[model samples]
Target: MSLAQPLAELLEAADRPLEDARAMPPGVYTNPEFLSHEIETIFSKEWICVGRSSRLAKTGDYLTYDLAGQPVVVLRGKDGQLRAFSNVCLHRMSTLVEGCGNKRVLVCPYHAWTYDLDGRLRGAPFMTQTTGFCKENYALPPIRCEEWLGWIYITLDKDRPGVAAALGPLEKLIAPYEMENYVECFRETHVWDTNWKVLAENFMESYHLPVCHAATVGGHSRLEEMECPPGLEAFNYHWITKEASLPMGNAHPDNRRLEGRWRKTTALITLYPSHLITLTPGYFWYLSLHPKGTGQVSIVFGGGLSPEFMADPRAEEYVATLKGLLDEVNAEDRGCTEKVFRGLSADAARAGHLSYLERPIHDFMRYIAERTGGYRRAFAVAAE
Candidate 1:
């Protein structure tokens, strides 16, 4: 119940006006106890995005995720609906599935208790003679799952509001992009040696682009032209209007929904807690984060092309180009975030004032403060 010195400072700093706001204190990232508090207060109750629905295209395709410490599985059922359930077996508590693939029925490797696509217990060998044991009495516990704008989100808190209700304003802001029509090209998971917030903050601001990504995306970012407006209750965002570094970063030749500025602009959005998205005219990529203790983060990284680009005759080349660029950008981000985490543990570490370009980071710090410290902070609507 005792607060670390730096964490206490973080709560104070997060309340400052934007012009006077400083970077969050080191304890925000280094305190193990606070991380546990965050898992319970934020990650457990929020709708955490797993990935795009397109990834589970077939009837039996399923993907597994570790939500905080709990194992979960999201899959496409035989009735053509997406459902989420506890990955642990009803009997003996063994994990039902590992990674992702097509499986007609989920069978526990430990006891061979089989479950149908709908999570009904269909078979259990050697349990037929067990007294008072009925297959109808057992099933995998269902988790709340919903699809919002093509993204699949799951939550352990069944009482939490639906994703669309929480992100309705965001949908209008990005309606022109038709996010649901984006075709997913790839998805991969990785664990990086850094606090989850460090990576989430890194994606929310563009100030580090020119220096951290100098070899790749930084040069094209046009820092002077970037817009860091106030954030909304559900998310924070910034925008940049510049020429696309890769051809696919621009609007596809057939795209007519976007106007002149929208065609060249990119939106960097961080949905409160841990969903970060980079939406462009022709392509999009996102990072979904979950803390793995105080020093590690599990990331669900994925990207794909817009409908226009997917329909292009040279779609394969566009896919290759976009994927290669994103891979390089991710590598650059990894190095920078890992280094920042190391610095936070040093004895001489100190928080510094945030720049105008780092507005999203400041907003993010306030969000953390509000959640973990139970502060009732007001949110200003973000500019489109």
Candidate 2:
């Protein structure tokens, strides 16, 4: 039950001698009980990147998304302030909005209950005469929201530490990028037939580049040339590869010039729990993984860069190039993850193991395990 002991055991058990082979057990991906625990411990407690700050740049701008399983609306109020609120209407639990757009106020389709950008209940039709009806106390529940480097992060748990504290040492690590200047360029959603964790683990390491993504990622950045930085800081790691060829259709205008310029790129920085942030040379993208059930997952991808970058003609081309590369990489990953999901579903008792190169998976699993009462508790009941 001691936190340190389980963490130490997980470190010892999951750690591998080979740098390239480290990974979490395959069982973790396929296990239902473990996945449920993650929803409670990891998703609920973590500070997840919900969207970009620019998404709510103007007053009355809002974006509705499913954070974990809870529907949430990220909005900028009339006062030019940003905040997050449970997207569900307090009256009937109906979702306030289905998507993102400019709205002076959020109006529930079920009964026209209205809420301001700051989540204050602005009006409730006919509720004034009802007993126990207090309009003042009927506001949409607020989620803890913070902006860092242009990314908007939300925590479902109100009592949790501030976003900076949850990010720990990572705050200083990404300080050099000045990420806030970027504007959003692309947004897409890809629903996978696999567990969310399976897709995420794919991003945590570079070992699969040679075999899994040879056509797109592998051809551009060779496995031997790819760098994997050390420690948990490395999980949010970024590396610059010189003269890397941009994928077709997504080429930057400066594609020819990238031969020498230091292009920035980053891997999974768990915006706590199921959200992930990745930065490439031209733009930054965020991935939010929402578990639909034990077997299905919804993945939302949002991309952006500074207004200055978007204004630059060359940067426009760069953004295009990055998108092409992402499409290919994601295509390859989706295929593999779907197959893994099918394989695991076909076998209920199978157990999977981790490799040393997958230290990020270990870090992620350990983080989850600590929050969920250790691996023994997670696995024991299910295995029995």
Candidate 3:
């Protein structure tokens, strides 16, 4: 298929500096074919965050993620190692499991085909009648699974470097928060009509805070204090350091070593492909995106308190308040993005100029151009 003209224009814009950059054209958000190309080139090959390994607290604990037309199970085995396997049953391709829980052995509800925690095929009823079929060779196929800072990430492309190697520079910056010990206090899943990139771009900048989040987070958004540092190979980031407006506004006692503004700062990171996070002194939250199609995305929203906040005697009461606050913010974001998606379909809609504050969006545009085959024209511009 020929590249859409509007998309080509957006690609040209992606090469421009922030002062001259344009918001991506509407066609890129509305075109199903472009979305298909993105899925094949980006999502399928990149390392994407699933959730915390802490979610699977014990051997046999498992969770599932559906992406690129496959349901994958990330399971903790008896050996205490986590492995990801295609969740399709071999006999008839039945989905073996749904949601998550402890399973000593995975049994295919369809034909009684069974596999151990490590995904080794242990039984296949009536397999003895098959001419030459062997159980040893029929184990579920494994997807590449790796972890960093207690977060579980998986990639379908075996040769791609692990998330740790790509994100090495971030380790020291993130260690002070001790996110490894932060427990998931709340999580929710929702489907939105907006394209995945729309949400990804929305979270990377604070430009919309004073208007988009006027009722909640906006009052505390100190534009003068914000900064957009250059993104690393693995992610793009923007920093916002100011007091939170909500009840958990008190500065973290654990933030002692964090410099002047760093003590109050929150790093908003968009891990290339689909992981987006906000790390704050008192709490952290993230949205891991999975594109269901050009116009639909599946979002797994999760957040928790910093260890210092969690250890406080008032943690339980604080948890309820925090969740409530985030729910409101999410509702606001969903409404705005969905409206933008709807507007994109209008004939009059066009790309707008970027703000200096939207440097991370510039980084994201460059990131996509560098990785996707559909943007080869844009890649040439970036190379120059």
Candidate 4:
């Protein structure tokens, strides 16, 4: 069988371009209409990494999260099965749960409508005699959900393809990790005043690592030695980096000792729309991007590892180090992206092209265009 055209072109271009051949379009980051379309077409149609699967390890455990402004609840039933439902209460359309917890039944704080762990409507405080108030039909609407590599992924579309099918080549790349064995050690949510696409693109390529994150994460590896395999159409890549040979300037006095501990790191991962996963030597981190508006994005960072790692005293210290490194890198990214957003909004440029160094982002944009049937329209707008 012959390779697809996009895939073939991507592979051929991967080795040739040292810089972006095309400018990244401004609409991807600054246009409200484009942002709305992305939320509806990109986010709702694809599988999104939510939280860690271990968050629902026990029966009755539940967590509430917002996905592109939609409130969702993930729960583990008494039978030890995982399920997801819209967090809106059936009676008054109020949120049934506010946060994560173990509950025998999810009772709406507004009108006291109750639901079982399976999302079946079990009780209502009032309307016992009301006609057409059957509990059978009042169950919370379910969202399609699946667990992969210790992460919980959900899709708003009930009929959309399963996570395994959607991930395609990425699943095979991450298969060796056995991520299900890891336990979550840390999770954090931060709001950024930038478009979600900016965050996705920033994470997809390491071209800026040398310039932007030079102090913390950037100095830890040599960018020149990094190798990106052929094929933009492939879902993932193998990023191999030699460990730090020397100490990074003491950004933190306490972490100065960890300079040359790790010998090498291999991040075998993929960028599926707005989600990103990175496997470090000691642990794994997943970032989920949920766009709030044209200029705002909600980011959730989740970390996973074995229970022993979580319980270790040194692990806490390591987490602190990691968090500090991430804070610096993320702040740098946010500063640049926010500035870019502002510039794009002020200029009103219709489009831009992608650089050769940004093949992953280009591939993603292509995928989105094909899926939404917007490639032709986007190109036409650019031409004008």
Scored against the true structure, residue 111 in model 2 reaches a CA lDDT of 99
lDDT (10s digit) by residue, model 1, range 15-42: 8999998999888888888898899899
Candidate 3, 302-322: lDDT as tens digits? 888877778889899878888
Superposed Cα deviation of residue 192, candidate 1 (Å): 0.5
Who is ahead in lDDT, 1 or 4?
1
Candidate 2: segments with Cα more than 4 A from true spot: 1-22, 128-134, 233-242, 247-271, 305-309, 314-318, 348-356, 375-384
Candidate 4 lDDT, tens digit per residue, 111-177?
8889988889998877878987888887888988898766788888878767766555565554444
User: Please, what is the whole-model Cα lDDT of each candidate in the order they appear?
Assistant: 0.91, 0.65, 0.81, 0.66
- Per-candidate TM-score against the hidden true structure: 0.98, 0.81, 0.93, 0.81
User: Candidate 1 at 155: error in angstroms?
Assistant: 0.5
From the highest lDDT down, the ranking of the candidates is 1, 3, 4, 2
Lowest lDDT block of 10, candidate 4: 375-384
Instruction: Supply the global lDDT for candidate 4.
Output: 0.66
Top candidate when judged by lDDT against the true structure:
1
Predicted candidate 2 versus true structure: per-residue lDDT over 5-85, tens digit per residue: 434544454443334334444445555666666677778777777667776779988887786679888899888878888
> Which candidate's TM-score is highest?
1
